[model samples]
Target: MAFLFPLSTFLLPAGGEYGDVRASFDEAKLNAYLAKSVPAVKAPVTIKQFKSNPTYFLTDARTVSIQTAHQVEREYTMLAAIHNYNSRPTTAPEARVPVPQVFVLCEDKEVIGTPFYIMEFLEGRIFTDMSMPGVPLEVRRECWLSAVRALGALSSLDPKDVGLEILIKSLSKVSLAQAAVKDIDTGEPVGEITGWRELIGWYESNLPDERKTGVRIVHGDYKLDNLIFHPTENRVIGILDWELCTLGSPLADLGNLTQPWVFDLADVGTLMVGFKNNPGAEPISLEDLEREYCRVTRQPYPIVEIGFARSWMLFRLSVIMQGIAARRARGQASSEQAHLYASFFNVLGRLARGVLEDEGYLPKSRAKL
Candidate 1:
């Protein structure tokens, strides 16, 4: 699964064009669909594809993003988006993180095989790297705080009250372990040196008895890239990629944010999406970020061992990588980085094992497991 190009190059395409794995839309077809679906939009609407994976179409005044029902149901994402829009607080501090307005939802099979939603394009800057040269340290800190506050606000809401009961569900650690085993069986490449089955077995055995399993709205993929920051102000204006939003442990999102600190960018590229690190800006420690999140949210520091959450996140990421590999194998992957991601399965597994070992969940004598 090794590629001629590095993971960074594979993930980031040149000239900002959609990557090969993306399904390109014919301009005429998109225009036709938009004309009918959004009558308010005038004729001859221009269409340009976003360079990112999960390709989006930018029309005259709005952006159209599409999602397939492969992992999470597209309908659930749509419902979550609507709920976020409707229930967003209007008052002070909590209103800082704004949800983009979802304008239209199209489910017509004739237009496309899968459902797509159109929403207002929030004008802002997305900092792919927190350490970028021009971005000040203060800005980076604000960005981190903004993300923490956003997650806090999200976790504060009751999923049932927001009409997300059907869309959000409690995640089972057992089910996660089972899925990891299945991924290995299904040609997900893992390390021959490490026993994945043993690792998972150890995880199951060490499951926290009084784990904080409280359900909250979890942003499945919360990271620097997924957030839209205000162009001038050092505040988060919008949060993107709601496809994986669900009712789960708030710690899951927190664990995701801490992933970059766990594995270097050079080692894993970008687990979520590839982006270069800002060499100029000093990096923040995972401990500081976690402390900030707890402070902003006023939630107690996690009682469950941090390693458990880290291991779960790593396992979750491995499953996602396995899916990407399966798609690449079937010629359905949208990004060139799919193969690169597939190649990292072993690395992910090893990292998960390392987390357990560091936390003393696994003994040195049994490290091979």
Candidate 2:
């Protein structure tokens, strides 16, 4: 059976303080939008904004959330997320999902500057850190394995089957290299971080032919925090934040999953602070996780050109972080962790440089922080 459940009857208190600093939406305007756009809801439906940053909302009987696309187009990512969720195969008995059923797409400038969509609110816990305190190690392991299965399931599907051919383009290693060059040429600011330019140059020069492969729908941000776990079990009930979903190498998702481990944040003053130090359970290594994922999917291990893939993914992330930093600087960012995100540009850049050096694409040299 589908993991369907009633919207939580009791309104849970907001997880954090609500204020101007936190991203929020106008309830009156949202209600007005709903009144006109979604026929299911009556005119006088109430909208309550959650205290969480990049505010989520709980309506009378449904949940509404907003996604603002500053660098990448929001509509495309939002639609992709919905499509992936709805189109995902239900073959796995254990893979229960409360996929978002987007009711309305609102682009009315008066409602909000950027476009937003209303979808079903899923009730579950979101573990933002690896250290799932108070949770059993076996349960944590199960959760991690469930996530891997979800990723494998997502990667195994054809993008064409879900009508994502146009919205999400398949990217090859060569295409990624070319895109890197294009970004640099367009003055995307390759800051004076030590190996930033060298890494790009490596990509431009060593474009590998064998790295080209079939495209899969990639959840750009596939981590424990983005997944919604069952209230009492280790199973993943729902996936959130499709803002970064795209068509790319499946390895990109793997790279994203393993990026945090590649760059330990013990002393980094970023958002992922305490979790690293106090991880309640011993985390699984990326290698073991990848092996199990390959075994479950019956796909060969991606052992070749793994380094290049890591560098490409990290470099792309650094570019994205740069855009976030720009938005935060201009007072246009919506994420409550905007400042923390802004601080990650250098850290990510250095990490990318480190990957390139390890891959023999660049000499062993530290990037100037």
Candidate 3:
């Protein structure tokens, strides 16, 4: 479903207008909830069609109107401030909400046949690049520095304090890794035989035994795009998208942000390059970001470890692309991008091999009969 906006007023119409045929929020119903929850409002509630991932509708008030049937624990979000009618305790009120400010939680299992959540429609923009645009280069590094510091602050939060330890611990399973060792869905790991072999070999051979004990609170999908920056202030206003948020190795968070997205650099320069050329912005390099993050976080450089993690990331991404390719090949998906995304996996696979080779995890010679 494609979204059509007024090009002037970024608001959702009374009915579904933006090629949004899927389950959507009932604005009337949501407004009623908000009106009851908070009495004197400054403006009429307007539900803006927001994210597609969790299928939510954002509002002009920067509060989420979630569509869910199940009762969610209000403690999971900004319930404290919502109940108090005050701002969050952590940051400045004018500063973008430090976290995705979730508002009303409604269920769609009955109304829309699926579940969704809503959050405040933030004022800032997602840069979608390695660098902060519209800022000077001297300050460009500081922008990322503050952004990384925010991430570190988030990581520093006690998992128990946030009640994420129990929730994420339940979700953190190595079954996927175990399954990769032995193909389950397919009769065997086909087309990716070498990739699989290399991955399993590296997992067993290279990773330190102490690595598994270092799990911590992770953003799960900690990429530049997931962060919202106040371009002028040069600080991360809010960290968005908590669906994949969990307690895991901090390396996992760093891996997702630093590791190339979709495909490695050889396959697609656009991932990082796109950040540099973000509208009205000057680009920054990946090296600068990584270095600054390490320095500020006081964490080990972990360059070799990051390299190993990159191989793991590529292997995981390949499985996803191949699945899409299979669907496209079967006419399940129509976009040519699906096919192109699939081929890009091949490039990542080659890059993963290079990573493993440099680490000496890959065999010097392939075993033969």
Candidate 4:
């Protein structure tokens, strides 16, 4: 299905002439149009499209007509925000997660009939399957570990420094102001202390411990496929899909990223939501990823937090599938295989409940999920 405005989704057409085809459209035509209309969109060789990977953004485009103006502004604004993050001198060295550079954002919607942007054409590898089939086990271990390190590096960045404070309240629901830098040793603001200048959403209530965690620019959707890896090395060359990016709990990204290991299809059967555990990389565990994340962030291993985050993410993924399924039922399915995801709603709910039970938050059940 061709998305108007592009990013892989750089284009899911809005109303007017593009009013209809939101549910289904020709990707080849869209790709060709992108190649012709946007010269900067090179081969996009790094971004490979796979139907099974579940990128279905099934929101109905009918009501989009009313929201078109607001949507246009929001879309272009986010593109600029991310570009700001990438263009910062300190971002590449500190975050270690590369973002495609936005050369220009055309919000007029007159040229392309929808908002679109020209981004750097990253040439690398995007493994749709989390298992990373055909790759060596050592490579898989290193690649996965590198992804963790990248996330940690991103989390450690101060949002204000990256020009991301403006997005916190509107997106992540946090208000940002310049507080004096805190000293790790003395536990007091060291810089010029100022009011309304602190990362206040540091404590997460969802976790068992009220530990103060670093506020990070959360990549709401962080997973293997969303990343572009170096063609030969195990390093991560780029991060994709910033639509869900925001300033929020680092745990949200960690939770979303680590769900694959927790929901091994062999162990949970129907409850397994997305990717399956790769038997080839059996030596590596979810804990290993957590260890790398903690090591990079210099934070203690958060066992309880991990459990909560994983279960929460499972429920969240299921809800997304459920929404797509609803759109499918309405005959507005953005892609062909949306029916495959409809059935996962109940099973994923069971998995989320099961995890809660295991953590002693819910009562145990004799019935198998």
Give the winner by lDDT: 2
lDDT of 1 by residue, 1-369 (tens): 000111232222222343343564455765688777775455455444444445454545533444433332443454445446456565346633366655566666556556666555555666665453465567677777777778776655555555555355423443344334424335653323234576666766865443354566777887766776666776776776666776656777877877766664665655543122534334555566777777766656753556887787787777666556555655676776777986666677777777777778776544332
Model 3 lowest lDDT segment of ten: 1-10
Q: Residue 47 of model 3: what lDDT?
A: 43
Write candidate 3's Cα lDDT for 254-334 as tens digits.
656655422334346552332322333433455665676566556655444666666665555555565555555445756
Least lDDT summed over 10 consecutive residues: which range in candidate 4?
Answer: 58-67
**Residue lDDT tens for model 4, 1-369:** 112122332111111113223333344544455556655454322222222331222122111111122233443455466567666676567554566555445464444355544445455666656666567778888988888888887777666665665353331121111122233445453221111111112123344342356566777788877777766678887776666666666877888887766675764454333344445444257778888888888888755576666666666665566655555555577775676775555566566666666677657767565
Q: TM-scores of the models, in the given order? A: 0.73, 0.72, 0.67, 0.67
RMSD of 3: 7.1
Clash pairs for candidate 2:
none
TM-score leaderboard ranking = 1, 2, 3, 4
Error of 2 at 154 (Å): 1.5
RMSD of each: 6.6, 6.6, 7.1, 14.1
Which candidate, 1 or 3, would have the higher TM-score against the true structure? 1
lDDT of every model, 2 decimals: 0.58, 0.58, 0.49, 0.55
Clashes of each: 2, 0, 13, 15
Candidate 1 wrong stretches, greater than 4 Å:
1-44, 61-97, 166-193, 202-213, 264-282, 325-339, 365-369
